[model samples]
Target: MLVVWDSTVNIYSCAVEGQEGLHSPVVCFQVKVTPQQFSAYKTLTCSTTCTLTGNPTYIWYKNGQIVTDNTSPYSVLPNAVDSYSCAVKGQEYLHSPAVCVQGQSCNRVTYTKRRICVLKGSTVDMSCTVGYYSTTSTFWFRSDKSTPEDLTRDPGYTGRVKHTGTYKGPFILRISGLIEEDSAEYRFTFKTYNFEWGHSFPGTTLSVTGLQVKVTPAAEGQKTLTCSTTCTLTDNPTYIWYKNGQNVQDNSSPMYSISSEDADSYYCAVKGHNGLSSPAVYGPKTTVSVSPSGEIVEGSSVTLTCSSDANPPVQSYTWWYKKNGGDYQSMTGPHHVFNQIQSSDSGEYYCEAQNEMGTDWSRTINMDVKYDPKSTSVSVSPSGEIVEGSSVTLTCSSDANPPVDKYTWYKKNGASLTGSEKTYNFTTISSEDRGEYYCGAENKYGHLNSSSVSVDVQYDPKNTSVSVSPSGDIVEGSSVTLTCSSDANPPVDKYTWYFQNKTFQNGFGQMYNISKFKSKDNGHYHCEAWNGRGSMNSTALMISLPGKQTSVMNAAVGIIVVVLVLILCLSGLMWFRKKASKSTSDTRHTADNGQGDSSPVYDNISGMAMNPTAAQTAATDDQDDVHYASVHFSRAKYEEVPLYSNVQLPQPQKQDEDFQYAAVKFNLPSAAPK
Candidate 1:
């Protein structure tokens, strides 16, 4: 049995009838296609040999329908494209494999698809041509799909394609509003009118280019940067320009604006590529400074040093000067020297140094020249006045380059010397030490003498007045004082006190004191004092014993005796009465008897007148004129009785109280012979 099947046929079979009654030697046959069926188009045809065997009947099916009267060793219609298969009916063992037909042409030409570049938001035309086509149906395919899918049917490409002339023999395709993803490989198909067709594979590379923005400056101008790229574009490429790592906008072509200060790092970039690499950076600055130059005095020496902290540090220094002398000159070195400096050597001066980077100037120095001297001076201590016997010091001061070597002491009396000891001291000063003194400072240059200092030695008392401590009439051992003072050339040395007529000397009297006063102590006391010059003495004062005041008491007794004699003689009338009474009684009793009684009466009257108011006159008893005479006789007898008794009288008898006194008559004593 034999059978054939092409790729167009999905199934095929054969039927047997009246087989149920058959008894002996009966066989049924069937054929199946392996790997289905295969096909070929155009100049392709089926083979004469079949894959089926055993010489039996065959059947073919098309699209799930049966076909009769199809017989051949292979299949019907050889050299034609078909969808048919074959089956075999046999007595035994019937199965056949399916086969496919491939085609080849004598002259085959591949069609080339056209691609183009366009600006953003523009249409893209894609046209292609193939060498072979007959009644070809043209179609488009996209390369992004696994099985070349139709690109005309994709929504992203809607309204984006316009087939020029109904997709004729050489197809022309256009895509409008083309997106970035639309730019890829596409395959175009042309179907012939009688089922013959041609296909082509085409590819397009998409790129976008931006406007060039060149930031370059003109010659002799600031530095500038630029940005640029290539022409044809499908998807718009993003631009990212950088300046020192910062984003920038560069819209103008061949001219991007920037400032002179913006000369630092610069570059440009595109979205699909790495950062830019065009512009370069610049550095290292320079500046200039202006300064004054020269010295403060004309022609004076001055130095100035200039330096800078620059990239290539300063190398050489130069001095540019307006002569402090009013001229201009140039010189080298940092210092300028002028010998035997003059007044013209004073002015303003400065300096400058130069390097590959820049130059700098220094500050000005003003110098002046003059003269001053150094020497020593002399001075005195206790400056003003000089007194005698008082200590004094004279000092000399001086200043020299190498210092002074010697000090000389000099006297006004032509005495001079050089040594560390410039002073002379006198212990027991005399009038000789009171003179003018001068001093000098001596080195190599001879001597200089200071002014003289004249001293006056004065002599004033040390103890002016001497005193005895116990006050008036001081006794021995009572401690007396002696002080001596004088306004003398020198001072007092010792004190000497004198007692009596002797310079007091003993175990007791040291100066003005004595332990005991003997009889020899009562005399004038004097004190004397002396120094080197002379002596002085105080006035003498006598000293005596404490109780010797008797001469004052004897003068008081003689004044009492002269007062007693004057009181006794004051009573003269008592004496006169006693004398006159005796005379009158003698005459009246005896001698007047022959004469008249007148003589007796006359004597009585005279006695009464003489002793007026006498006691005897009051005692008499008679009141007669003769009674006056008796009073005379009684008074005469009382007066005539002697104060002292011549002879002794007898003792009188006792009487009573009534007895009266009688007048006594007595004889007168005779006168004494002369």
Candidate 2:
């Protein structure tokens, strides 16, 4: 995921110095960048450590190509990822270490210091933030200057390339007994658990240089001095002279002459390198100054000159301008003349004097200037047809000598002052607020008025309602009208009718005419009023169609039939259940009795009974299991009566046991209903 940048204005560009150790101390070229956060943008600056005399020219390059020519502390926007390096124009062979910066994001890498200058034969460590998620192994390698080999295994770096960190980094790569060849673009690489990431960026450049001086005797008991580097540099750069730990006024050539110089330090550097000075040698000091010092006004003419005191007199001088809030501008000459000055030219001014020893700066001086504002105008936002109930704004502007003090607003033709502010705001606009409006601006010198502006306000239809003609249910094929009405400024343009059947009928005007309305059209209806500004919808109006009478009749008949069927079914179910339950219970009751059915069976003789005991109207128990028929003959039909002897069982004792079986008497039930 990419990180969102806040609103800030930051441009990333920088100038670093590189030299062939000519008059300058030989060292690797590198730009060290620092991030500064501002309201506008985020930026990175690249700085370098190089020894040079007078103001040396600087050239900035990106990925080995010249991008800009500027002095040290140049800025580059950290808006994206890019590699950069820099060099002295004349000594193009030496380039500062290149650095690539990636903003805060996945696999984002950044180096604290992009370049380092170390003396030859000294140990040094280079490090950077190698961003990786998982387990990662970091390795160090140089660009084309060296192969992509583990420093521990590469024959050249073996034993000398110290691995100070494991797989995890910000891991440091340490080098021991560094040689001149070690001066190259060093980058760090690493592998994540799932993938490998490598980009050409954020590489450290190392510069190695050794200082040496040649002294020779001159005539008249004087001595001549020359400052040089051990290695032969690319271009033969003029030497920069410095005395007693400060830059000398003379800045040119490696030779310096002294008659009685003692107890002061002296050094030299190549042009473009003012950082690494040769070993300090006992010598005299020099102080540089401008002829006329202190403040000056704009458009004023002034003469500025540079002077210095060294073993050899100052050779030349270069004037430089420093704006109050801007970068330095260089002008070469022994003396600088300003025929005319402007407010933009107001700031500090100084000069650079150079000799064989080194280069130095003079005390700074200051300048100032003045100006004001002139015309006025007004503007409106959203320039078009204005809608009622919407907000609107009018803004006023003016130019002046000193600046504008305040703004006033007014309504044209009305002759009334509206407000006393630069901007006129309307929270909710209405027709009354519309008119020709203008504004006036006043400053220290004078005041001016702006031209008039016009405004229009529009609104929508209001209080819309729907009504049906005849206001009652109409039979099929009858003509019906639905009219939409509302109160609006321009009147309703059209009316749209919607029916309860969920259908929209094509319509226009106020009245919706429905000719030959049928059953399908039987539903509630509503209409909408529309105008140029907006629209409004009305309440529903019900419309009745023919054939609704039969509908009620059919519905009632269906309900009646359904009720009858339900009643009949319920009765049948109850009857079946009751009959089944009674039959089952009767059978079970009879079986539980053990004596079988209790119904009696009687016998009726055509004449009177002959032996009452044998044919007595009685129920008897016997082993034969006999059954008797019911005596149902009418008593009136029988007249004669016979007497019978009492006949008991042959053995009374055995009779008790035989009586256990009971005789079944068949009885006649009552006659059925006719």
Candidate 3:
């Protein structure tokens, strides 16, 4: 007979009816469920590797407990937590291995570890097993909030968290350089075509902690140092010891013994993870050193490093420097670097190293950076207007590591003026010295030139003169102009004109014009050119009329002479007429006395100078008539002067008496008598 219990199945030999000491062939079977997946109802089936002797009854069990004694196929409601098995009734002692009802296709998750603990600055991996029908996506997330957030997308875990594994499998979440804030519950989630694994399932919780050294008193002036943590570290890792930043020992024990007088700082770390070490515990001793240790020069790379022997090392370093008697300024870093040093960077410098324990200062160091002159310039003394013949000075200034050894002066578009002197002086500055000037400053390293400065000289007008247009022999009734010119530092601003020692009202400009020149316009003319500095007068210019005017005076004198001659001739004529009148009166009286008997007597006094034929005719006509005088004048031609004649006659005789008169004519010779 064969018998089975809830926990075990046994097989035994029975006395057969005809044969004893013989038993049926041993048999083995396996338990299987229909569809091989979880459901509300499942059918349990049993199968054997070898054939049974006859029709065999079936037996079934659930979770190590009998559910039925005989059945064609056992049936039950399946669950994930229960186990089931089946066997033939006669061979019940050889039952099949127990199997969970829910198979590989169940929608569930199981974390490998419920909780994990790790040291700060170390890496940790959380793993889980997943079961699903057909997963589309899977990821690891932190379950600290109601909404699950993927660790890979979290801001605090960027670049430090990652996920590894396939869908519906053992998934892993790896986080490096862990900190205290990384302590949280981490979960795994997956999604199928229609269903998603719920996030309410429990997940693995992580705890991150830091290491510290605990010092304790010991015998014989000795100290015991233990590398301790807030919680027990994972993997039971070995501890390493460091003295003054140097590795000393590594062992499984966390305690280390040392002398109490040891001044060196001590720290510890895990054997495999030396970078994540405990904080050193000691008094801070700070010092600073420069890299590329030599004389620093301009445009060279330099670095200053601050070192300290402090419990936690130097968390911050501050650098302070002073240059050219100025105030001190600060910079922060473990290393203060100058990518390209300058002349102004030459100064006294020091550093301060600080930690949680305390702070310490380094010794002051003078950084005398050698370089060429910089910020070179030329400064002029008496920066006002530079007048000609005035004393002036030009000084060269620069900033250099080594004081400028040589100074040079230069003029634009000219040669160097001075050498090796800081200042250039001019006792008597002239117009020739006015130009653009610059200075060159030099040291042992290099040389540089400053920007140019303009020197302008101011002076009064000079070399003044007046120029005349239409230069020679100015004629009357013609136009003329006088222009004034002068040489001056600044152009002549005002011009004045003078005519015969008097200012011309219309001559207020550089040019004086005479539209219609007359004799009165001829005189001495001058011009005065003026500027802001002073004024100057030009030499007098003589203006005279031409010789055509002298002929007019000669014609006027000739007319006056002709008028005097005419007056003399008229006076002589008047005198002769008076004498003639007196003679005529005497002759008339004597003739009247002698002429008694006027009808019978006749006097033949022919005093008329006439032509012969005219006189004979007059004598025959009137024998008794007496004529005193008669004058005849002819008409003058063109261009000839007319002559006037005056005649006086006696009183008229009786009206009835006959009076005959003869005209007399006198002819003057064309040529004068010798």
Task: List, residue by residue over 1-674, the lDDT tens digit for candidate 1.
Answer: 21222111222232223443332221122222222246432221222232434444554433112445345433333343323333443421122222322233111223332234444344556665443234345566774667755666777777677765343345666776655566565656544454433222223333323334344444554545545545433345455566667767634233344565553454555544433333333322322232224223323343344444432344566766664557656787644555445544545556676543235666654444332212444454556544445665656565431245666666577666344554445444555566666655555534555666565555444334455556776664554554333444555666676655467554122245555665455556766766565666666665566664333343454344433332332222235346546655543444335443221111223222222222234322221111111221221111122211112222233433222222322212233111
Better of 1 and 2 by lDDT: 2
Instruction: Quantify all predictions' global Cα lDDT against the true fold.
Output: 0.43, 0.58, 0.71
**Positional deviation of residue 286's Cα in model 1 after best superposition, in angstroms:** 28
Off by over 4 Å in 3: 1-281, 310-312, 322-330, 344-346, 355-357, 471-476, 545-674
Tens digits of per-residue lDDT for model 2, 98-143? 5565533335345545666665556677777644354367677776
> Per-residue lDDT of 1-674 in model 3, one digit per residue for the tens?
33222211222222343554454444435666774355567777776544445678777765444667866566666664455666666554444655566764455566777678898988998998765455688888877766877778889889999898876667889999899998987878887776666664446778898989877768998878899998778788999999889989998999998876665688999988888888888756889899879889889999988887776556788988898568999999878889998777888999888764456789999888898898999888789988778999999999876889999899999999856799999899987888999999999989999999888877788889999989887878899999999987777999999988799887779898999899888777899999888999999877768754443355577666645544543343345345434455444554456642222211122332233223333433442342223233222222211111222333335545454432332222223121
Indicate the residue-level lDDT of 154 in model 3.
Answer: 84
Clash count per candidate: 53, 57, 2
| Error at 6, model 3, angstroms | 33
Identify the runs in model 1 with alpha carbons over 4 angstroms from their true place. Answer: 1-115, 166-168, 193-200, 203-674
Query: Which number leads on lDDT?
Result: 3
- The lDDT, on a scale of 0 to 1, for candidate 1 is 0.43
Q: What number of backbone clashes does candidate 2 have, counting pairs of residues 3 or more apart or in separate chains?
A: 57
